[model samples]
Target chain A: MRNMIVASTSTLYGGGYLEYLTPFLSKRLKAASIKELLFIPFARPGGISHDDYTSKVRAVFQTMHVNVKGIHEFEDPIKAIQDAQGIFTGGGNTFQLIKMLHDLQLVEPLRKVIYQGVFYLGTSAGSNICGLNIRTTNDMPVVQPSSFKATGALAYNINPHYQDPIEGDQHMGETREQRINEFHIYNHIPVIGLREGSFIDVQGTTEILKGTLKARLFQAGKAPMEIEPETDFATLNLNH
Target chain B: MRNMIVASTSTLYGGGYLEYLTPFLSKRLKAASIKELLFIPFARPGGISHDDYTSKVRAVFQTMHVNVKGIHEFEDPIKAIQDAQGIFTGGGNTFQLIKMLHDLQLVEPLRKVIYQGVFYLGTSAGSNICGLNIRTTNDMPVVQPSSFKATGALAYNINPHYQDPIEGDQHMGETREQRINEFHIYNHIPVIGLREGSFIDVQGTTEILKGTLKARLFQAGKAPMEIEPETDFATLNLNH
Candidate 1:
């Protein structure tokens, strides 16, 4: 069995950090019977320190009466994951997060625990790791990971914080759609473009698209399709 | 002597591919006594085939009476670079271009030829490879190269297609500036955010910022500075 909430971003437009997610998150945590949550702040957004980033998350979870601790504080992080009732991976730089995950050799262990039914939550870069690989991440390559392989908790790759092309914008950088199209040229993996405020709620084999925004689904050699909210992601053939 | 024209993009606003660059390109080629240009089409913009992409560039250069040949057409790409009088590496995907360069072991040969004053021109992804590493590139990681290590023809990295933050836009994706800042957190290599229409012209040790736009200079632990057009980039201490 698998249980996870993979969100496109920690904060939605005009909302505070974790504010928009709290209601949905509380419901998930409550159903999972998780009180204490272990936080992985390895992504280190804006280069924030581990303790500082952890405190930010702690402050948010505190409102729900949940105890939060960063994984870095633990002497044995592997044991921390093994013992945790719930886990949250905050967003930041995907390269750094995957680099640390590989360097600590925690990918397999984390994958095993999550597949065995541990409660897990991931946002942005955190959500990216839940995919088969980190190839579709939108973050800068601040550092190099040992391997692009990720947790693979989900069958497809996740393109978190996916944005539609801005109308009338003169900037020549490839649009998000163009970039994903190029990705298909080299890879056949199905990619789910999770816009901000959108998420995938996976329980057992049922993965539903949660949140109000629509998600864009891209497959190799096929036109991109818009996936509506409340759509069951499992219904789609994601495994290529 | 080293002679190179590294540009932020191949196309400018409302212009055909290489249209804005043709005037400058023709002058440079004439000065270098070049009749034919060798093209590297591995980047393959929009997933165009190498022959098709090469043909596009060939058609453009043909207007100036300069014959063009793709390196892929040669059985010995290494020898083609060694013998070419002028070389042009067009833009597309940085990862794909660097991957091909590494796979064919052409990085060192290309560097040697450019250093030997072969009159090289690079746009977008092509310009990115002239740096110390591809770490600062704005392109998506559609594919991973064996190493981030690039040609190192330039001491610093290039952030091609650099754009400033959009005013009043609510998109949460990190702006190009913020992305570069994140890059500085893990890297000490200096980055030149070459805006569209801007380029760096390198002759021997002197590198000048050309075109009508200003470039942004980014270094670790320092605020990004706006570099004016016509500024001699070589005067700046970019090694830090």
Candidate 2:
């Protein structure tokens, strides 16, 4: 299997949430001699249409000399992925993404594509689907999903947009750390707090952290730790 | 005209992000002689049906020997609110509530009800509608509304479920205070951080502070200050 890349942000040209990957993504696809890339924009932000947002992503792929297509354009996205060379799912609201995934029954196809060695990449909500469930997501549960299930693309849950706590505030609401901890209380799955610039590059079954910042890992009844990018995170042997 | 009562929590029953308010709500409603209460449970946490959540609020009113009707029960909620004696919007999610209010054209009706002597009581998302916009709300923007407009019942915004800042956490996301500050940057509305067990009781044109604890008030380009519930907040000068 050639493997997949699950990123916390897009490898876009401008200052995107995942601007760090702009060069890396282009270099990898070119070196791999990849001709076409599939894009999934199901995690539509605020329940808005996918066309406008995906167009921006398509433009990014065009710059890389790679053919790009938004999966929503296909009547049978499952079959489209089955016959695709590579895939990329952009980020947005996790709730909306999961909702559309469930509604369209694309979660299973996505899982298949990753396992079939189709070279997949997911950013933000795309990265979130790499987990067993979307419960660890930082996105608010604005709309209830048909299911909290995801593609199980990774062994651990992901808390994207991971942020450091602020000082001298007494608002008493749950912090992002607290929110992730709540997820741990219910699921024993290890959580990877992927900072804005972080991503996990997967080759076959081996998951490699690819970024400068350290990703925080958390499991049930355990303290969180920071591990540098390029670390063999999949070897942690901390499966739930 | 009768004033408004914005609460921090809903049922005083089982729910996440809960705040206690039975003693506070009852005292103010009785003092205002608010007998008929219109219940709006449109936020519907967990995607529970609106009818089921509305019934629970109705049960609360029944226990208090007050006549209650769910706004959903009305053929035209806008007209119903116009003729209703009082209004009580229960909390769930702010985004959903604001979207529904905008979709049904009930925002103006709600504003008129509060202005035309109908006592208004909102808890959580319910309380959020009292502001000029839902910008300072804690709920996730699951769905986008036609506009960010709200009832403008209060001169300032309310950040309920306010928590103190967590110490020694490395999560680098924007804190609730920071998010509210961002809202102020784009707009000039002030925000009031009302913690659990805290509330605001307005009668006539005067908005008096209630509850046992002090609420934090923040204005654009100004440091936040703790104001006791008993302190006449008339300096805000919203009432005319």
Candidate 3:
């Protein structure tokens, strides 16, 4: 059994950091009895320091009386994950995050604890790492990771911060849908385009879509479909 | 001596494929006395076959009375580049293009021919490979190449299809400028943000900006500057 929140964004447009997620997370924290969490700040949004990223998250959790600690602060990171009751991976560059995770040889350790039923929260780049691989990410490859393989905590991949094509948009760059379509050529794994302000609330095997916005579901050799907010992803049978 | 057109895109918005570039290229072909050329259609847009992509390019070049041969048609791809007096690399997916060029071990041969005074034209993903590396490309990493390295025919990297931030964009995804800022933190290489319709025309050592719009020049630890249409990129001193 797994309990997790795979969020599309850490901060909504014009919203304070973790402001939109606090109420929902507070309810989850109480339900799971999770008073503290180990934060993975390797992504470092805007190239911010690990300490700064952790402090930002800590400040938000403080409002809920839940403690947050950076994984870097620990002498033994693998032990930190093993002993933690909860975890949250913040947003930033996925390549940077994956490089560090592989460099420290923490992929297996992190995946092991997640399966052991640790309450987990992943936002943006954080949500990306919980996929089968990070090939669907929208971020620029600023650094090269050892491989594109990621923790298979989820059956499929997540395309976080997914935006629809703007009407009359003249930009020649590939649209989000087009990029994902190109990805389908190389990979058959189902990809969920998680729009900002929405998330997948995983309780046991049922992955329910949360928030009012409609999420896009893209699969190989199939037309992209609009999925309703209350839909349970488990019903889709993504596994081949 | 080097002669090349590193174009931002193969197809201009609301225009036919290679239509906007035809006149510019027709004159160059005549001046260089190049009646025939080799085409590199490896970056198949929308996953088209290499032969199909070459057909599209061949039809366009046929309008100029310039015979076109795809590198795939030749038994020895390296010899094709060596014998060709002119070359044109069509645009599509940068990662796919880089992987094929590297897979065939043709990076060095292609770069050598460019400097050997071949009249060359590159658009979109084609233009991206002329840079120091592929890190600044806007294309999706659908397929992982062996490395992020590119031909390095040009000293600086190219950010093709560069778009300006839409006023009041509600989406929270990183802007083009913001993404480049993150790239600056990890790399000091100067990046030229080539907007649609803009290209750098390299004649010998002087890479002069062409087209009407101004290009965005990004240097690590410095402000992004707007370069005029006639400005010579060789004056930037990018080698450092």
Give the candidate number with the greatest DockQ: 1
lDDT of 2 by residue, B100-209 (tens): 99999999988877888787888888898898877677664435466767888877778887655656644444455655554554457778888776778777667777
As a whole number from 0 to 100, the lDDT of residue A181 in candidate 2 is 62
- lDDT per residue as tens, model 2, A1-240: 647777766532236544577688888787678889877887765344578767877777777788888888898978888888888877766766887888988899888878877788788778888888887766644345667788887777777777666575444444566656655544678888887778888887688888788988877888888888888886888858
Which candidate achieves the best lDDT against the true structure? 1
Q: DockQ for the candidate 2 complex?
A: 0.09
Between candidates 1 and 3, the DockQ winner = 1
lDDT of each: 0.92, 0.73, 0.91
Q: Quote the positional error of residue A215 for candidate 3 in Å.
A: 0.8
Q: Write the per-residue lDDT of candidate 3 for residues B104-166, one digit (tens) a residue.
A: 998999999899889889999999999988988877788888888888999999999999998
Candidate 2: list runs displaced more than 4 Å.
A11-18, A46-48, B1-240
lDDT score for residue A16 of model 2: 50
Query: Where does candidate 3 chain B have its weakest 10-residue lDDT segment?
Result: B231-240
**Model 1 lDDT, residue A170, Cα:** 88
Docking class of 2: incorrect
